[model samples]
Target: MADHRAQDKLAFLLSLVPYLVDHDRVSVAEVAAHFGVPQSQIRDAVRLIGVSGIPGETAQYQHGDLFDINWDDFELNDQIVLTNRVAIDDSPRFSAREAAALIAGLQYLSALPEHADRAAVASLMAKLSRGASAVPSSLTVEATATDGTLALIRESVSTGVQIEFCYRSAQGEAQSRRVDPLRIESFDADWYLRGWDHLRQGVRTFRLDRISEPVITTEPITFRAQDVTLPETLFEGSPEDLLVTIDVVPSAAPLLADYIPAGAVTTEIGGLFRTTIRVSHYHGLKRLLASMSGMATVVEPAEARTAVAEWAAAGAARYR
Candidate 1:
């Protein structure tokens, strides 16, 4: 605790000199009040500054080597004034690593839906590149899927082509499907591919991470991006969206965004995130809970938990 206090005192003193230099001429009382310290502490800082400066080439402190202050004004009126000021650094630059980090962040911002100025972000990145003292290592922000899956989806969307991929369904079944690439959207850290499915014969949403063996076919898209009307939310709703409230782990909450209505409020209870989400029926909810395992538990509408229990018993009976 004492060492921490000493460190804090050193930081305060280091900052005090810069503030005093910026003000040029300030009262001891004013400095103390500004720093939220007592008047004595301010006077002590002034005395400390009086003796602090860079050493000359000679191993001894020369006349100008030490900071000088007006003693009369300090003694009589408690006014603080620096007669000798050391050189201050004004042109500070970010390190190569720091510049690279910032440039990477700017690149990500440019890709966001709300960020409109790509040129501006590019200009800033160029400035950072030049201002860096050393060449930064080539670093970039990659999409949520890094195995060339997102790139293929992007190619399909841009070229107006249908993409074929083996999509892993909610029931852990993989089926070969072709989708007319409509739009690629991101929710939080996860990315979703919304397109017209040839097999389902309707618009379907697929999680990019679950899509595998993606290939862009030579066939052109039946429906273009501008022609289709996408829902404000990624998933289209029907009269069958059964609202089943559940207590899910906080980390898994974003995965349920498709089921969570836009206006529904989620609350935290008993160290779990409590939110209501829509499912087609109780059987589907039971399956979802089974997949999640212990990551989530049903919290309300008692039938939801009962549905899960019944499904488990029925599965066990088959084995028996």
Candidate 2:
């Protein structure tokens, strides 16, 4: 079976066939370029379409049901010529659920004042609602607020310019730095700027909300190719990664799920959830444990348990 994402691409490719046929014999390379896909993908799609057709009277694909193509021209000259095909010119209509999902997504995007064209977004939503069999009334998508800092970061990213800004670290230390904006991405409702940090001379991820007084620079990006890839795991552990387990109260189990990676083994015993988490170092682990207050406790790695206790003690000393 084809992957779902590949199936989606195939569906999109099928929709383009009508337009391609209307233009007469089009080059495979031309179609591939227009769709932003590889030439091989276009050839494969055309080949797949050639073998597909409606079932005939025999209940098997035969004669009138089989699509015909100018194989000689296609294979030899890299051209597509549909000799015989069932009329498939019309665009597919969206189902009620599909239309509703699109409307919700568009509604969220439209609310972003920095990026949306209010009038155009409204027109699109109206058209989608008109086509939908049943418009979704219960669905609502709220947008995050936009501010000058976000606008400055976005501008820097779009223009391929470096930016300088004040960043408050997770430990609450403030510092000024310059960075080449690679991309602005959001994970779990928090926006982060992943870029090449000039001060640290490395790739770093900074929370967008932590940035202040951002200044877009005239200076162009100077980061090397090797410095571009963001790590698969953002905060790496010292030496090596460790698998840590924690016993959580049932009430706090839901919160633990958010921090735990997918597929990590979890078990419930006597109303307590034993959840395993992977972390790079004690610093991050301690912080996560601290966030749970007194609802969670380390179950293994005595060192981590001690570290968390010490960390809590240090935090307590500040108030004393």
Candidate 3:
């Protein structure tokens, strides 16, 4: 929390100018309460703001450029009075990436008919684009959840109901499971349903796209305090997970950075980049290696190399 003080102070300063201008005069305690910070912090922020100003004619902080605060009213009494300050009437502008993020989120929200105000979303996106420094022409975000899936998940969340769905695991196995839906979240370009999995007897996060035959059950959700406190990191590597190394071509090497764990060493040997990646499961690794075509090859761990070879051979046989 202490590390975020600089950010908090900047935000306070931006908001303080407008707030002080609107109220004309306000107590230090009132400002602290409104901002949800301690009075001392607010006083410190005010003191900092008083010294902050635009450069004067002489290129120094002169009296005309400095923020004027009524020292008598603030120091003697616990009140604040701003005599003069630069006008901060305009709202803070969003950067290009920030604008893009909001626009993308609005696009996702606009996909759901139940929660969408289509016109408002369109208007806001237009405003964001106009305000952005430079909007990217090629940036795009695909909708992660289908209308039916989103509707059912949202209904279950709102009514505290249990939901049943046929989930296709990463290993390509399908199984029926009932879950008390807690929340729907989007992470890493995918929508996930965080719920209490009845079959596993634990909180699990299921990718929405992998869910099939979803049914909003009549049964009410069974309250579990632990479900609400489930960790955001749903996937964890186990001891059984494979530590497989792959040699990727120079052009494909950079792409592996997104998939490989941080601090994983990569070295270029004979123009091919080699890096080790921990595979949570063989099926997932096989699928990833298959998608890379012949650009990537398993270099070590004879088991993984053999598995990928067999997987590739099978795929080749299908085309032949």
| Highest-scoring model, lDDT | 1
Candidate 3 lDDT tens digits, 104-154: 887777654234347777877876765555663445666444668877866
Off by over 4 Å in 1: 1-98, 105-127, 131-137, 140-146, 198-202, 247-275, 280-297, 301-303, 306-320
Where does candidate 3 clash, by residue pair? none
Better of 1 and 3 by TM-score: 3
Q: How do the residues 1-320 of candidate 2 rate in per-residue lDDT, one tens digit apiece? A: 46998889767766766656554578998898888888998888888888877776798877668667899999999998777655352256577888889988887655332333467877777667644555555568653453566667656655657889999876578999899876555655577777789998878888887888789899986863344776765443344667788998988787655457668877888778898877767786886776777788898899988888898889899998
What is the TM-score of each predicted model, taking all chains together? 0.46, 0.46, 0.49
**Which stretches of candidate 3 lie above 4 Å from their native place?**
1-105, 110-145, 182-191, 219-234, 249-273, 314-320
Clashing residue pair totals per candidate (backbone < 3 A): 0, 1, 0
lDDT of 1 by residue, 173-230 (tens): 8999999877668765567778888898888888887899999999888876667787
* Candidate 1: 10-residue stretch with minimal lDDT: 109-118
lDDT of each: 0.79, 0.73, 0.76
lDDT of 2 at 285: 83
Error of 3 at 6 (Å): 44
Q: Please state the error at residue 56 of candidate 1 in Å.
A: 24
Q: What is the lDDT of residue 156 in candidate 2?
A: 66
